[model samples]
Target chain A: MTASPTPTDAPPLPWTCPFCALLCDGVALARGETLELRGSDCPKARQALAQQPADTAAATPTIDGRAASLDEALDAAARLLAGATLPLFAGLATDVAGIRSLYALASARDAILDHLLGDAIMASVRPLQDRGVYYTTLAEVRTRADLIVCFGTRPAERYPEFFRRIAPGEPRRREIVFVGTDTDPAAAGPDTELEAVPFAGDAFDTLALLNALAADRALAAPPPGPLAGLAARLQAARYAVIVWEPGASGAQGALVGEAINRLVGTLNARTRAASLALGGSQGGYTANQVVTWLSGLPLRTGLFRDGLRHDPWALATARVLAGRNADLLLWVSSFDPSATPPAADLPTIILGHAAMPPVAGAPQVFIPVATPGIGAAGHLFRLDGGVVVPLVQARDDGLPTVAAIAGAIAQRLAAPASGAGS
Target chain B: MSAPAAVFELRLRALPRFRVDLAGVTPLALGALGEAEAGRVAIRHGNEALALGELFEIRRRPANAPALHFEGDLSRFDRLAWEMEDGEIRVDGPVGHYAAARLRGGLVAVAGDAGGFAACEMAGGELAVAGSVGDFAAAALPGSMDGMRGGTLVVRGDAGARFADRMRRGTAFVFGNAGDFFASRLVAGTIALGGRCGAHPGWAMRRGTLVFAGETPAVPATFVETGHDLRVIWTLLARDLARAGGPFTALPDRRVRRFAGDIAVDGKGEWLLPE
Candidate 1:
């Protein structure tokens, strides 16, 4: 791959930042004498684009800490995978194309595929599976929802563009209601009304009371004053949507989401209401969707002989590694440069971003891959599971795409044992 | 030449985890189309748009009839017979989430167990599961006001948590043990649990009849024992439950004690405990 030419006199180009699930596509990139990034200059996007090319020039395939040719690295990785009884293809932080190729490789090897955010995905998915949730897409939240009730975590810390994207347009005003946590009062428009329903006790108990309130049940001891009015406010709304993030809600924060979902269910009985989950950073939702479609199960599943068996607890990547159930590990992180292979006592192969720093003790093989929306163009699913935005190529760092690397590995795995005999 | 009964058979060749929304693809709707067109029916596999023929084998057998049959263990298949207006769909094996969801008019029978949210948000239909069922059966979908506005859901085996939640109008009879929060926040309906139940049965229910023929769990503080004699409704409901068959077969003759409260709410919901 060749880097796109940076004209000395051209205007800034609109680029989509692929670092987060928000897929904020309005970034302006100007490749002048010094690379300049403007627009939603989020800390993550700015940091990603401000790196000097010289620092990333050290990207090269390696075998056991020693520099090696691409063929030599692929050969070594294939040898390790072909010899292993059970392999784990994990640390999937890439675009749709990258994950699709990884799924193919995992299927050929009958390996267990898991994402970096497997636990977080399960936190939300478990509730949706056991107890259904009514969710809306980001677009729906932007245009239709009138009452936005944010539960627990603040959206700005993780997704800086969250408030900007969901801000209502002209002639309309939205009400921003925060529950569980205190937030900045100035995040919304001056015309927009903001309210906070702070409560004591855990998220589960608070939401349970809210559920009963929404159901019009009388509480033995009524909750705090602010909470007492929440039921009436929700009932009076024309269209209401509750928002929460499973990842930031503590260890069992997803339980809060489950409770909020039940409340939404109860509220919808009389009025129009829905729920929205905010955080899906690092391509977690995309990976979960891909895995579910191909395997008929979510993350933490094994490609057993019968079929893919989903056991979030048993098939967790960490647990599988700790139990020594997997003989080989294939870590793929194509977006974050600092995302290195986890310290495991097993043969490891890495398909990482070009700017990824070298670990003290390197893996058996390391192949630097192009970051989507930077060096390659691909599709990425948004957090709401409604939109699949395009990741346009801005500049190529002369690195192979994860799809090409994983595809090469899959082809080698499908070959006869004679190919491995040598 | 068109022969005997028309039976459309879809045998699962591979397990699909993503829910296949079988909402509009009924036998009557697809009977006019040829095998090729039927194969082109749209279904979602994860993020990809796939053809129904790519996943299931679609074939019309004997004659052109409005009856569909499925074979294989479809425990991963979701939303089967969803919102079907009029037809017959039979699953020879287990099914996944939202099986027969929003069903209007149909006869859907699963020979094996079913996943959560089965018969959810249904308007009218008859859904029978020969084996067990997961949570929220005959319950409203998330953010929907009414659950199973009109239908009949009969689960032969055990049911998990939050069964019949917010059911507005329907008749649900579970023959086995039910998990926590049974008939919780019920607006109006008839629920008969022939086996033991977990905690918080009839939590905050407004108006509904929950008949517990077996051991009943603890009622919430919001609920107060009314000790009312409901022999008239009990006799009629018991006979209907007996017709469904189960431990409730002898429901008519048993003496009952009543408690009405979710006083928290309308306090009109009735919980009949067999004495």
Candidate 2:
């Protein structure tokens, strides 16, 4: 049996740029209109963007799989939602603003507006919004941090350029350390320690590390060779960082958060510490600065019990979805809703921009708006507790701001609520 | 090195400064001023402990030192306060985790994504997303729970899993998407998505909001919407979100709808629909 030549003997695909969720930001266009796969970015074109096989997404997604006029596509989408009884207003989540618009439509129409993250992360985000906490961002890490740790997370594919901006060789360097198994081979550098602990005992590994360094005692997996010595290094570090990658199964996710608190508690005893997410591995999306500026909450609430409660389970988005609660669906998402309750069937109304490769099903009325980061100007809060990034909205066909749209809608809804607000 | 303490001024982008700490100090506790007290007010380092000027040339506070700049070797540091009340700090290169931990005010544009716990337990700040971030990018520390209180964490790119696990409050947004089991144990918060997210995000989330901007398969634990999207009031929140920097900031004055629940957790959470 001839196995044929490997990629070494074959030619490469055109190009794939995972710059956006559509994973269509930078794609390869062949001379014959037959596009080739781009590099690492196009996971769906290679791996999978929305559970749809790479080959499935590689079919050149269009509303109907055919190149139709822009108007025709919009009309078709409108038709789908108009006639759909159980229409779910879904977003591709390629861009945050686009999906938000769809969410508006979902809210107005009581449809399901969701994307991948909506399902994977939002479950917890819903409740967290009801609570609150403190944090920072990547921009802050660039020049501020001195220590970094890779927990149950990896930053390889999602943001390949991640290392270049924060590593030692850069104009402003920071320390690095790995606490999980040797998953990200590229993360290891001469200056940092990439320890390979038993993947199973990750929670215990973290506790053990903290105990040995912070409490001056051994806990789990006594850490061998360089790791044992690394404990002393960690304890002595003036500014230290910790990173953990939960890996494929996602078995250690729960422990990651607790481990972090413990690590920070211990590290704060001497040196300073900070953290960031590896890529798509997170539960909630930090809202723009305004949300927090006013209510001290993200999309939910922020009245914590002294110690900010970032617990989503407590708020119960699932219960809300199933209970058919909420007088209105205010989906102010930077992206699309990532989750859908098993029994969710709500009337969705949309009020934001529309992301392309629309979510499955249709909405009653879908209005496309401006891509905030691209068409308007605003302020966004970074992951770090207090960093605020100025948003530069690009003027695209003169669309009103999401705020304006929402304001107008609010005015309309308030008409009845206040009996005369409108 | 002219403008010593310029309050309420955001002078970034044009020209920034990076000031390194000569002495090892917990930058998180120490304000940006303490970290930047180089030149005139230096700290104790190794040997004789030189001043900030001795170790790294202080650009001086700059008649307008564009807020932030890169100073010394930060390879041995942590808790780089990327978030300043006002002003900027430029890290010419890579930095550590909690890069700008607990940032509450100001603009921080990172050239790269930070390490794990990058923005754990943050309150209020605008963290730019030029690159990507690690696990819990804007979430809480592993055991000692508590997600970002109130802040915005935007990721221009994708991220690893467990993004905002055990989050109590705040919103963590991703321009791209993330890996699996993302918001598993979320407490309360709103997680919006711009891209397709990974799998098993809200496994055991009790109460929180999960928004999917991209297409994804259905989750078994999650029940379909039992109610509907609340278009009218939803616009208010959506508007606020957009103005706050969401891509949908420019949506029209339409209605909003709502859906709810992870049947497992009382089924109270929801998905806001747009019309």
Q: Which ten residues in a row have the lowest lDDT in candidate 2 chain A?
A: A52-61
Scored by DockQ, the top model is: 1
lDDT of 1 by residue, A1-422 (tens): 23556785677777777777888887777775555667865776777676535334578898887888888898888988777657788888888888889888787777788887777777777668656889998778778877888887677777777877787665577788888777655457746888778864556445666776788776566567777687678787888898888877664554567677877887788888898887556778888888888778777777743367676654678866765667788998887877777777888898987767776653468888888877788888888876888888776567788888988887787778525421
Query: How well does candidate 1 match the true structure in TM-score terms?
Result: 0.63
Candidate 2: misplaced stretches above 4 Å?
A1-147, A169-175, A183-200, A218-227, A244-255, A277-289, A301-311, A314-316, A326-343, A351-363, A394-400, A414-422, B1-275
Best by TM-score: 1
For residue B144, what is the lDDT in candidate 1? 62
Tens digit of per-residue lDDT, candidate 1, span B149-244? 888998999898778888999899899999877887788989999899876677657799898877766555455576666788788788888898
RMSD (CA, angstroms), candidate 2: 26.4
Candidate 2 lDDT (Cα, whole model)? 0.44
- RMSD value for candidate 1: 11.1
The clash count of every prediction, one per candidate, is 4, 322
TM-scores vs. true structure, each candidate: 0.63, 0.41
True contacts kept of each: 0.09, 0.00
**Alpha carbon lDDT of each predicted model:** 0.77, 0.44
